[model samples]
Target: LPWHTTGKLSTNRVTSSCSRRAMPELLQFKDASSMRKYSRLQRQAGKRIALVPTMGYLHAGHMSLVQAATDRADIVIASIYVNPTQFSRNEDFGVYPKAREEDHRKLLAAGCAAVFEPASLYHPGTVSSDGAGDNANVVGAGEHVVGAHETFIQVEQLQKGLCGVSRPHFFRGVATIVAKLFNIVEPDVAVFGKKDYQQWRVICRMVRDLDFDVEVVGVATGREEDGMAMSSRNALLTPDNRQRAVCISQALKWAEEQISHREATPSGIQHEVTDRISTGGGRVDYVSVTDAENLQELKHFVSGQEVLVAVAAFFGSVRLIDNVVSVKQAG
Candidate 1:
């Protein structure tokens, strides 16, 4: 159940299993019920498989995850499900960018072996429904309820900082859907982007704590030439907002420079960074410094513990988040 692999797996069981008369053939499934069949096959072969989960509208960030899988796995399966639970009612769940057909083409281009794009597979409750998983009144259950109704994965202390403060249920929704996807897909490894630094860390912890038989790998955030991190939501930005939204990344860069030089305290770094984002005519939502892995608010920066500088802001009506983690610099 340890997150870190010894890389020297016990092959006795593996050898015995392969020696069985008939190992199940590998197959991919899209819906939740079909997952059992795939799970059975994976258990039979003990072969490596990987999953890359995304909301669709593939960008370099996603493609990077796919390529990472190709490097680490014998088979790569990407699931494109715009997780409805991950979105708040007012948070553009209905209109979040989805390009299923385009995503299929992109995954194909990226050399992914297969993709499971589940559509409208969730239970819809009422507007008054509390965001609890136990809500009894299942009003209109979508065809993909198994895909939709996930037992939420909550990693304690990891969700204490960052956008979790404002978007209270965001990570809960994320954790639930991701836990389900992780369970349904049952990949040997799963990939996530470092751009969502907190989410990535939370998921990493969830994998370790829940004893999920999956390795969580984080690919560095893919970015534009001008240094802004790429996001599918970037498409929503108007030209002027797009130009000014660079302030978020720019601020994070400036803060990272200060931290590297020992020139700024966390508070000072955050204030200056938030001010910079705001000065660019964007409305700052939150700018925080936290323990890099756990996303806990930082009281002091210790030598071994990494630091995370994260910010979210509104560029026009669209809210965007960008962050920098204290990754070791190349020599």
Candidate 2:
């Protein structure tokens, strides 16, 4: 394995296997400049690169993204930076679960070619410490300082509803960091899990509108056997809260069913989902029925048009989100 930290590169050997062939050593890069240079070299060699950007708590959901990227390109680079800009002042950035060595092991086993683990994309010359806990002082949405990163990217219309309504600063941070990754990695394609439906749509719209020459691929959301969507925050759930969290997926499925049968209005479905989650011991953040493509909240269902039923709820302080898309059929 090769680890690039503070613009210095060190190599180590790791044995791994992939479906295509015996995998090469896993490489790690901690700085933007080194990764950019490596990406340029790969591009010059006529290799197709795919990027799977993650926050570094590797779970099955993230590995699915890596597999999706591996299937598409010759080289797969997974970036494991827990973006500080995305977190709000009161958010869980400080306590965000991090397992760097374990994450590296999983990516190595999944046959990822390289890991871009930049410490501070916004602050030049800032190096990452061993864990996310040490980087607690990294600036977030409103915590700007003199000579700190001030620029942010926002997809105006798409980021207005759903999760945006609650975590207003979130999508801007996501869009900005992702744009920086697209520029740094310059991958031929990028993979994102569709669990965050609004975020996926936001990134797609950003790529299209900004004219970034990268293909954005959305993989289906990975779920647990009990129907709960996989998330890093799931680790924070108490035993009781974990059980309660399943209602999010259950509500989404019920909403999808209602849409398919045309048995309820969009508002009716939203209210029902919210009530179900609340009854299940979770605090309802929002339940929205919106146009799947544009994310405009829908008041009436249109046959043959896809609408998304998305929800975000708090299960004992751990917020979980899940969504489902369905199209009504003409009678």
Candidate 3:
């Protein structure tokens, strides 16, 4: 039911107009050999472009970012690559959603100027640290071999806790791919969703530290009426488990209330949140309070350092995460 548009349109009607736009033509690339072929078209268009990268299986959360990109730039290019490098052997990489044809239709329907539905590994002209190609393994030349690890970027410190703690290699893989995307897309601005608050913070810090000319903008997380954040993985939820997913967001709200009412200390808040979710039959991943800026745990809250309560839980095979932060939270 949620709809939005990119570029200039009446605030009330952007989504509708975006829908009216034609379904985007697919820009498929076999490998890094094709990056030039695609970027060339972007350059020829002579318009500022924006990038919104995601794992595909588009939902309103991603659409929100795409629409924001369209609002800021003349063109929007969304990448739906589920980079294999980013996932560990035991992670959700195997189960990650891949709705290729459907996603292409969604991207076109979202009013994006181009869809970088790269076929597989993109050379980016940057070889892996091990001096091998990333796509070599996936391409399967018939002899049976694993491809090389292309050069990937890593951002330190900022990724210590939050989602980073659970997914050890997550930010490193994210930074690497994001860096690759920036280099490849070369957009004037890029969009990221604020739902994965830690991911946004990591990318922002990377852009600043790396001195990437592109601007990084964050769109708010899109939510269901029940307050569950929209995610493709949400489809994996059972009807009953789907209802518990809302508890992640609800517990976040309850924590916000605790802080707003000043009733729970950081420890008290953590305890209460974990108790609430666990009692509700949710498998708590990690619940903690931290300094909003540095992501360091707070034994107690300071006057205004900004505090965030973040949680991740398993709902069947899907892991749902939700966070609540102080009004002026730092990071």
Which candidate has the highest lDDT of all?
2
lDDT of 2 by residue, 58-132 (tens): 899999999999999988999988887777767888799999888988998886988898767875224433334
Collision count for each candidate, in order: 1, 2, 6
Candidate 1: lDDT over CA atoms? 0.72
For candidate 3, give the lDDT: 0.72
lDDT per residue for candidate 1 within 273-321, as digits (tens), equals 9899999889998999877766767765665457789999999878898
- The 0-to-1 C-alpha lDDT of every candidate, in the order given, reads 0.72, 0.84, 0.72
Error of 1 at 122 (Å): 3.0
How close to the true structure is residue 42 of candidate 1, measured as C-alpha lDDT?
A: 54
